[model samples]
Target: MSAHTNPPAPFAGVNATWIYTLGSIVAVYVLLDLLIITDLLSSFADTRSRGMLALVLVSVAAAATRIRYCWFLRSDSGSGLPHIGWTIALFAPAVISWGIAFVIPEGSFFAAVQLWFSGVLFALVASRRLRWWLILLALVLTLIPILVSGMAGDRVELGERHPATVLITIYSLVLPIMLISSLWFWRVVARLDEARSLAAELAVTQERLRFAADLHDIQGHHLQVIALKAELVERTLATKPEYAAEQAGEIRLIAKEAMEETRSLVSGLRDVALRDELENASEVLTLSGAACTLEISSLPAGTDAQRVLAFVVREATTNILRHSNATEASIALAPARGGFELTVKNNGVGEEPGRDGGSGIAGLRARLADVGGTLTADAGRPGAAGHRSFALTAWVPEGGPQ
Candidate 1:
C-alpha cells in the first residue's frame, strides 16, 4: 500500500474564525471613532472637517491592513518586506490630527483620543520591536496636544489636571496594552492549533510505520525458510526423488501456514471494537473544537458487522476532520431494520465539490457491501442560518455477512 500523505491542516476554519473575530473588534473601535469624528465635523469649518474625514478614511484602510497582516501571520504565508505604505497610512491620521490640535486647539481632546485609538489598532501589526514604540509614540503625541491645548488657556477642559484628561490618558496608556495582550493570546491559540495538527499527523505516520514493521515480522522468517526448503528440494531432486518429494510437501505445508498467518494478521488489524471507535471519534472531534455527542449501546464483540461498523466510524471521523468546519457532531448506533444502524452527523458541511461522491465514501460503500451492509451519505438542506449539515449512515445485519 502507498503511504498516506498528511491531509490539509484541520485548523483553516478555526483560523478564519479568529480572523473574523479580530476584524469585528477592530471594526467596533473604528465605528466608535467615526461617531466621534461625525460630531467633531459638525463643529469645525469645512476644510478642517474634510481633513478629519480623510484622516478617518486613511485610518480605516490601516485597520483593514492590520487584520490582513494578522491573518498572514497566523497562516505563516506572508512573504517579502512589510508594506511601507501601510505603515505610513497607519501613522498619517494621528499625525494630521495632532497637527490640527496644535493649530486650532478647539475640541482637540476627543479628536486626538479617537485618532489615537485608530493608531493603536494599526500598530498591532508592527514588528515586536516597533509595536510598543509606535504605541508609546501615539500616547505621547496624543497627550502633548491635549496638555498644550489646555495649558494654552483654552476652555477645552483637557489640561493635565482635568478629570477627563487624566482618564483619557490612563485609557490611552492601558488600551494598547489590552489590545496587544488580546492579540498575543490569539497568536498563542494559533500556535496551539498548529501544534495539535502536527501531533495528529505524527500519530498517523507512526501507526503506519508500526503496521509495516508488524507485516515484515510476520512474513520475513516464513519467506526465508521457504526459500531454503526450495533450494533443498532442487538439490535432492537430482539424486533422491522420494526425499525431494517429501521436501516439496513440506514446502507446500509451510506456504499454507504462511497464508493462514497472514490472513489472521490482517483480520486482527481490521477487528476494531465499535465502542472504542466511538470514543476515539468523540475525543478527536472535541479536540478539533466540535462538540461531539455519542448515543451508542454495547454490541456483541468479534462479529464481522461490528468490525465493519467500527471502520465506518473511523472513516467518518477522518472525513469530518478533513472536509468540514463542524461545530457540532453526533454518532448514533442503534438497532434498525433487524440490524445495527450507525449514523454520523455534523452541522458544518463544507463546499468541497463531490463531497458525498468522493473516493472515500465510495470505498466505504464497497466495504459495507462486503459485510452485506449498506451505507448512505447525505448533505442535508441548509438551515435558516445557511449552514449545511451532513449525515452518514451505515446499516449491517445482526448475524454478520451471509
Candidate 2:
C-alpha cells in the first residue's frame, strides 16, 4: 500500500454514531436556549417582529451547528482558522441578530448570550494558539453588550443590586468555560481513537516484515547450497562420470527437500481459518472508521478453497483500508452457480473507477485461476449521491481446488 501524504484527522475514522450523538446533544442545548430566548422576548415585541427575530436566531444557530458537524466533528477542524470568507460567514448572522435585539427591550441579553454560544463553538475549532484568545475576546465582547445596555437603563437588569444581573453574569462567564471543557474532552477521545488505528496498522506492518525475513532466511540458505552443488556436478562431469551422476542425484534430492520445506512454510501461513479472517477483517475495518457486515452460510470443512477465500478476505480488507475512503463495507459467502462464492463490497470507489483494478486484483485473479475458480471486480454505477461502489467476487467449486 502507498503512504498517504497528509495524515488523517483525529476524528476521521471515529464511529459516525458517536459523532451524531454528540451533535444531537449540542442541538438539544441550542434548542433549549432558543426556547428560553423566545419566552424572554414574548412580552417585549409585536408578533411579527418577534417571529422574525426567532427565525434569524434559528438560522444563526443552525449555521453554527452545521459548522460544528461538517468541520469540527468530521475533520481536522482546529488545525487553523478558517478562510476570510468563512470568518465573515460565521459572524455576520450573529452581528445582525445582535443589532435586531438591541432595538427590542429585554432582548439584548438573550442575543448576547446566543452570540457568545456561537463564538464558543467557533473558538473551539480554532488553532490552539488562537482558541483561548478568540474565546476571551468573545467573553469580553459578550460582557460589553450586557454592561452597556444595563448601565444605559435598558431593561436587561444588569445593575449591581439586581439578583438577575448577577445570575446572568455568572452564566455568561461559566457557559463558555463549560463548552470549552466538553469539546476539549471530545478532542482527547478522538486522538486516542486515531492512535489505536495507528497501532493496528503498525502491528500488521511488523508481522509482514517478520514474515519476509523468515522467507528470506529459508530461501537464501537453500538456494546457496543448491547453487554450490550444481557447480560441483558441472566440474566433475568431464573426468568423474560416476561422481557427477551421484552429485546430480544429490542435487535433485536437495531440490525436492527445498520445495517441500517451502510448501510447508506456506501451508503454515495459510492455516488461518476463513471464519477468523472474516471476524478480523470486520474488526480492523471498524477501527479504521468503516462499518463492516459479514454474512456466511455453512462453510465447507477443511478445503483448499476455504484457505484461498480466507486469503481473498485478507487482501480485500487491506485494499479497502489503503485504497479507498470507504465508510461501509460487507463480506458475504454463500453457495452460488453450483459452487461457493465469496463477495466483498464497499461504497468507496474514487472518481476514477479504473484505479481500483490494481496489481492486487490481478494477483487475486491469478490465485483463483490456479484453483479452477474465478475472480471478478466491478466498479459499480454511481448512486444517488454520486458515490460509486466496488465489489470483488470470487467463486470456487464445491469440492475445493481442482
List RMSD in Å for every model shown: 21.4, 22.7
Candidate 1's TM-score: 0.54
Q: Cα lDDT of all candidates, in order?
A: 0.67, 0.67
Q: Write the per-residue lDDT of candidate 2 for residues 180-299, one digit (tens) a residue.
A: 565656667778887988999999997776466435434544454466557767887999989889878867876786577568776675254689778867866675567899899967
Question: Weakest 10 consecutive residues, lDDT, candidate 2?
Answer: 156-165
In terms of lDDT, model 2 sits at 0.67
Could you estimate the TM-score for every candidate? 0.54, 0.54
lDDT of 1 by residue, 1-402 (tens): 798887655446556657655765666555554555465555444446655565445445544554444443342222333567655655565566566666656656765675577567656655666767777877777778778877888854335323345544565667776666666677677788779899999999977764654355345534654665677788879899998898789779868966886787676643445686688678767756689999986574437787678767767776777677899999999888878899999998766337555766676687788888899888888776666898999998877776
Candidate 2 TM-score versus the reference = 0.54
Candidate 1 pairs with clashing backbones: none
